[model samples]
Target: MPTERRIGPARERDRLADAREDERAHAVIRNVRAARMVAGRADSAEECSLLLEMLGLEPAAERR
Candidate 1:
């Protein structure tokens, strides 16, 4: 005989919430890094612009 696994409503909600939180956290990190690059954290505006272009995002003429 095969056994069936079940998830209660509360547990299901918790799992969904955790997944969403993970996605949000990742987005926050990416946005912060992008902002830093745009603000000239590591390299010049031209270099960052080139990087952004390569990633298919618009190149900014100057740092943010």
Candidate 2:
């Protein structure tokens, strides 16, 4: 059998990072919310390219 690797984001869209009762759990949850907020703000591929450039990443190659 050949080993395989995932090429994109994980299938589990949401997950908890800590025990439900842990005080730090709120911070973890907040980080997820912040990520979603940024993802929601990008309305187009061009916007995503700009965001990546701001983060100092090269724009991904165009897909066929």
Candidate 3:
């Protein structure tokens, strides 16, 4: 039977780093939205907070 090689520790770490970067990108968007609210240009801080929550993230919590 043909088998595939499993990822080693380094590759696993790289994958995790990539996932973290993706999450940070999302956080940046939320941060921008929250900033807009602070700047008096938007009225959807609640909506932005909800988006973050739906992404398995919570505003004001440390990123995992």
Candidate 4:
């Protein structure tokens, strides 16, 4: 005979929390990429600066 393992409510809740965090991280990445694309196509430095500021991201020069 063999015993089976089961997930408790606590473990389930932890798993859900981890999944939500992963989703939030992925959303942040997507938003950053989208902002980069828009910034790349911006007509002027001022526009790019404003877009980066609104997205709460640093400029490319400062990232390195």
Q: Each prediction's Cα RMSD?
A: 5.7, 16.3, 8.0, 3.8
lDDT of 2 by residue, 1-64 (tens): 7689654444333233234446577766765565455557889877866775675455434569
Candidate with best lDDT: 4
Q: Model 1 over residues 26-58: C-alpha lDDT tens digits?
A: 977786677566657537767776767665556
lDDT of each: 0.73, 0.58, 0.70, 0.85
- After TM-score superposition, the amount by which residue 46's alpha carbon in candidate 3 deviates from its true location, in angstroms, is 19
TM-score of each: 0.56, 0.34, 0.52, 0.63
Residue pairs with backbone atoms closer than 3 Å in model 1 (clashes)? none
Off by over 4 Å in 3: 41-64
Model 4, residue pairs in steric clash: none
Lowest-scoring 10 consecutive residues by lDDT in candidate 4?
55-64
For 1-64, candidate 4 gives per-residue lDDT tens digits of 6588889999999999999999999988887797789787999989988888887776765565
lDDT of 2 at 24: 76
Which scores greater on TM-score, model 1 or model 3?
1
**Residue pairs in collision within model 2:** none
TM-score of 3: 0.52
Error of 4 at 53 (Å): 12
Name the lDDT of candidate 1. 0.73
The sequence of per-residue lDDT tens digits that candidate 3 reaches over residues 1-64 is: 7598989999999999999999999988987676445435425777666665655545564549
